[model samples]
Structure formats: C-alpha cells, structure tokens
Target chain A: MAESHAHTLDEVRAAKSRALAVFEPLAAVVGVGITRIGDGYGLKVNLREPPPSDTRLPTEVDGVPVRLEVVGQPRKQ
Target chain B: MQLDSARGLKRALIETVLTPFVSVGPQVKILAVPAGPVAGVSPVQPSIAVGIGRKAGHEFQIAVRCQRRELMTGKEVEQIRRKAKNEVDVRYIGPVSKRAAPWTQLRHRPLQIGISTGHVKVTAGTLGAFVRKRGGTDPHILSNNHVLANENRAKTGDAIIQAGTYDGGADPADRIAALAGMARLRKTEPNAVDAAIGKLDDALEFDPRTIRGLGKLAGLGAAFVDEGTEVAKLGRTTGLTRGRVTAFELDNVVVTFDIGPLRFDGQIEIEGADDGPFSRGGDSGSLIVEANTRLAVALLFAGTEAGGENDQGLTYANPLRSVLDALKVDLVAE
Candidate 1:
C-alpha cells in the first residue's frame, strides 16, 4: 500500500475545522523580481526539514518574505 | 613541331602533370582571339582554357583543345578562333575543380559500427551520429568530407563498415552519407572540404538535442569566435566529439608549400598551433556545433597526409550552409 502524508489537503481542513481565529506558521512567501521568471512566492519552507524554528513577525528569513497566519496549533515542536 | 597540330600543347601538358588543378581531358579545349575586337562577333574577354589533361604531354598540343571558363561561373565558354593577322592571342582560364559523377544512388540506411574494437553491428555506429533524411527519403548520417572519402580511397556506396571511436565511443562513419558530384579524388587549393552528409532510415529514432542542433543559418554574426561557445560534431573516422569555440576567423592564408589542402574551416582548430587542433586522422567528416545553441557552423575536412608531410598540422573545415547548398539537402535533425 502506498503510504500517505497526513499533510494532504484534507488533513489541513480537519485540523482547522472549528478554528475561527488562530495563528499559523508562515510556510512560504516569495516576491516578484523585475525579470519575473517563475512565480515569485512570498515565502517557502520545507516541513520535512524545517528551518530553525522562529518566533518572530514579518520576518525576512532565508530570503523568503513571511507574515503570520491563523492555524490553531502551537507551531509543532 | 608544326605551328598548328603540334604547338606548345606539349609544354602545357607537362605543366598539367605537375598541377592537377589544371589538367587535360578529352573534352579539354582553348580559344584564341585577337586582343583586337572582331568585326562581327563581339570581342569577348581574352581567350580561355578548359579541361586539363591528367598525364604528361606536349604544351603546344594542349593550348589548342581546352575551353576557358569565366570568373567563378562555370557557364560562360570562350572557344578558339584563328588569331587575326599579327595580333597576339591571350591565354584563357580553366574550371575551379575537376569532378566525376557518382554511379550508384545513395543508400539511406544507418551505418553502424563499434568505435571500441572496430566491431560491426546492425545499427548506426554510435549515439550522437547525425540521423538525417536524404532528399526526403531514408535517414542518413552527417559527417565531414575527409571521413566518408576514407582518405579519398572510397566512393559512394563503398560499404563503410563499423570501426570504433576516437575514444571508446561509437564510429561516426557508420552513419555517413555518400556525396555525389564535386567530390572526386579530393583537390587541395580550397583547403577545407570538411562537410559530408549521410542518409538515415525510418526505423531509427534519435534525440535531436544529442544528435544535431536545429537552428536558422546565421546570415551574419559577430564573426569573431566567442570563448566558451559549445560545439559538437560527428566525424568519419572519429565518431562524435565536442569542444569550445576558441578564436576569430583568420583569412589570407600564407601558404608555405603544396600541402594538398589549405583551409581548416570545420577542422575544430582553435588559435595558432597546427596539427589538427583537436580531432585528427579520420575525424575529417564531423560537424562543429556551438555548445548550447547547437548551431551547425563548420564542416570538418582535411588534415596532414603522410610524413606529416605538411608539417603545419593545421586542419581545415567548410562552413555548414555551404554543405547544405552543395549537397542540396536540408538538416532533418532539427
């Protein structure tokens, strides 16, 4: 059987089913360069190998633009 | 020797022996007209000579028989007319090169051979061998003139069996196309005769990227060689090889001796040093391509013959489009 990642789209909805307001980790955020080659996302992160956990706001970490989001979970330790 | 039947044709015959470029043939003829204008026929450019004899003979006898050709154009013909009273006749010029028509029609099947042990298989010699279509028929191989001519020994349909590569790669000659006209016994003046094409078949499929790059023929470019410009080729004896563009175009060749051939257009030669800058011996038929663009630029052609006789190991090549126009075919590998 093929192993499935709970991080799948369905799991995301289940995790936030009842949450009306919450904060989530800014996973990916990129910006647009003048040349605009590929889409410029404000931020991007790898859950498999997350960057050193941060507790900062409006961060410019790892060349990615970040902003806070609502997630109802405590940034999984 | 009589003034008419046996004139200086004997001496001219001797000169032809020394210079293959101008030889006497059965159809050879020369025309003589007074530098003075003729009354009826428009006085044409001084008399001309055509068709040279290959063997030794008297010069006087030869002057009477060859037709002279016009500048670069093999069309215009000037025939001999009795010289007017006391008027000196002018000498005529001959054709750029002598060639024989090919007998057998070309075979478009892929030529296969092993570059490692000269092994023979039923496939094109190796990968990267240009698989092209012949006159819109079967697929063929594209290489340099030096390669398929096999040092000028073989002709069209001469069954180019498999041979290993310059390294351990496949043999390039396997996929070579047989040339028709303009290629006979290899001449020397226009030093580079490097380009040659082959025909491929339907059964064989190839990756255009790996085989040959398809692009528009550059009408004009920097003309200067750009460093790091990638290039690739499929040679007759050497198979396929790649390199970087080294320098700018150099002309006005200061020829030292009669080294059989002169230009190194697609020879993959770089700056100065002679001795086939990169490929040697059988690598004569390969194509030179710019690295990323894969633009077919040069056609690999001649190198030094025996004795390293022409010590200037410089190789020669012909530009690519000339190859296409000369062969009257298109690059099917785009």
Candidate 2:
C-alpha cells in the first residue's frame, strides 16, 4: 500500500469521525484512525482482541472501506 | 631473500595473496599457519597455509572444519601461490566467527544519542535526542519522562545517567545531566506526550545535533502525515530499524505505566518494514525520523508485542511537535 490517496484528506477525516462514533464505545476497540487499504484509503479500527464470530462490523463507512486490526494492548517500550 | 627487507614488497605480497579471495565472502579467513608435514608439501619445507573456515551463525566461534571444500577454487589458490612465489597450502578448516556487539549499551565520553540512558532510579531507556529550551543557549538531553525523570517521581535537579542502572550505570559515576523538566503524565486525563529533558552537565561534552548512524537532524517533521510514509529510528535495545507509518492520529492508545495505564491521543503508529520489530523494551524515548529526509518525526514511547500483520508488533510514538511544544524546547538543529 502507498501513502498516495484516492480520497481527499477531508474524506478520510470524515470517515474516521464516523468510525470513531461507531467503534469508540466498544470495550474491545483500542484505537481508530485512517489507514491505507490496497490502493486507496480507509478507516482502521484497532481491537484489543478478535470480535465474536457472530459479531458484524461495517465493511465501509461513508463510502470509505473499514479495516479491523486485532492489535493487543499497547505498553510503554 | 629477506622477507623483512622491503616493506613495500611485503605489503604487495600480502595484498596479492588475499585479493582473489576477497570476494570469497566474510566466512573465509586467510591466515599464515605454521609449516608442517601436509599433502603436496615437503616435510622440511616451510610453507604458507591458507586456512578457510565457515562461520557458525550468531555464535562467537567459527566451524573451521568446513565440509564444502569446493568453496575455494583451484584458480584462486594457484593465484595466491604464484603471488607468494612459494608453496601455499589452501584448505578449509573448522568454523571461526566473532559475535557482533551492540555499542549503544556501552558508556561513552561526550555522550552520543541512541545509547542506554535513564534516571538514576530507573532501570534503563534511550537518550532520544538533543534539544534546547526555545531561545536558550545551553543544550539538553531529550528522552521519556519514564527515562529521565522516573515517571514524575524525580525532581528537577535529580541526576540522570548514561548506560542506565540496568546496564550497570550508577549514581554520581555515570551521571551526565540533571533533570530540567518533564511533561507530567496524568492518571485520569489523556496525555499528549511522555517526554522530558536533562540539562547537560558542564564538564562533559556532547554532539548537540547528531544521531549515531542517522547523521544530523535536518529539522522537525510534520505531526500529521500519510499512513504509509516510511520512517526510521535508533535506540538502545533495537539499535537502528526501518518502519512505515501504519496509522496516524491514533487516539485512545492506552499505555501501561509504572503508575497505571494512561490514555494517549493523536499518536503515531509504526510497523517494522522487513519482518523485524521496529522497537523493543528499553527502546523507549527513541527519536523517529523520516527514512529519506532524516527530518525528526516523533518520540517513540510505547509498543505492542503482537496483533500486527507482520507479527513483529507495532510501535507508538508522540508527534515531535507535540513533544517539543509540551517541553518548551526545540531541536538543536545546528
């Protein structure tokens, strides 16, 4: 993936805002931000652990794709 | 013919004997072994034996007994013999190698960045960079509060040491600076940075703007950049590593501290570029910079062991602008 974006920075920010509003309250979620998805941009949701098998997360937010990453707890290096 | 008669002739012979095998790789060692009864050499004749060995990976010892004899070509061996004008016995011996050591863990005079350093009461951390209070003349050592200030437990005049206590640095002996200031880490509120500085001691000398391998800082980098922007860092534990910005404006990054877990917002996230981790324990306070420009990017403070795609873990850093603004300091760019 590259930093060059198909979507404007504003689009990514708006998408991030929507992702945060939806994912921030979840106990499993740790962080939310904009990330590169293939050749384009998307909202990245960092989870403390994998969500339930039956759990459903949006694949896209406001036309931007959503990528879920299972990043365990971050600690001071 | 006296072997020691001409220094130039001796140097030429040595160069000729070793030149052809230079491309043979670092695993091969050419030494002058004592003349002894060996195949193709007379028992009474003193001969030059070229011993080629293989290196045991990551070990200090070499396996001189190499089963791959074809590594030494007959043409190269003949060239060495022809250069010496004497019988040269070229053979593969047991492996022999020297382990590479990390120099950043050692104490150095005129302290350099990317070395083991921390508060006298703390175990160890990295000396990230050098800076000065805005409009100030004196230089300061920059690092995490957990490093130079013992996580807010230390006072302004507390001693800071190089090589750190965990690396055997002691109070009054390895001391190089005094704590100047820190961006206090709050327990209940979100924090923007985990940084602090130490007023450099008058007696010691230090390079105010250079990193060990990355060269001098060009200047500060943008706090917000694209996710895939490449970056690099030099630190105590990991030495130097390359990584790519995986996430930006990362918020709610909960970092476990000595006091407790604290939430950080608008942080930068990095993932190792080539399957290795970008940073590890004891690497806190490392300065992250643009891989191509060497522009200061961020102050690395936290990381995760797993959950990244590369399996090498993820690193978290505070934007350099936030760190400097919080501490009221500027990079000593000169």
Instruction: Give the least accurate 10-residue stretch of model 1 chain B, judged by summed lDDT.
Output: B29-38
Q: Every model's DockQ, to 2 decimals? A: 0.01, 0.36
RMSD of 1: 26.0
lDDT of 1 by residue, B78-111 (tens): 2122221112233444433423311111122333
**TM-score of B chain for each model?**
0.41, 0.70
Report the number of the highest-lDDT candidate: 2
lDDT of 1 at B130: 45
Candidate 2's C-alpha runs over 4 A off are A1-5, A25-27, B1-101
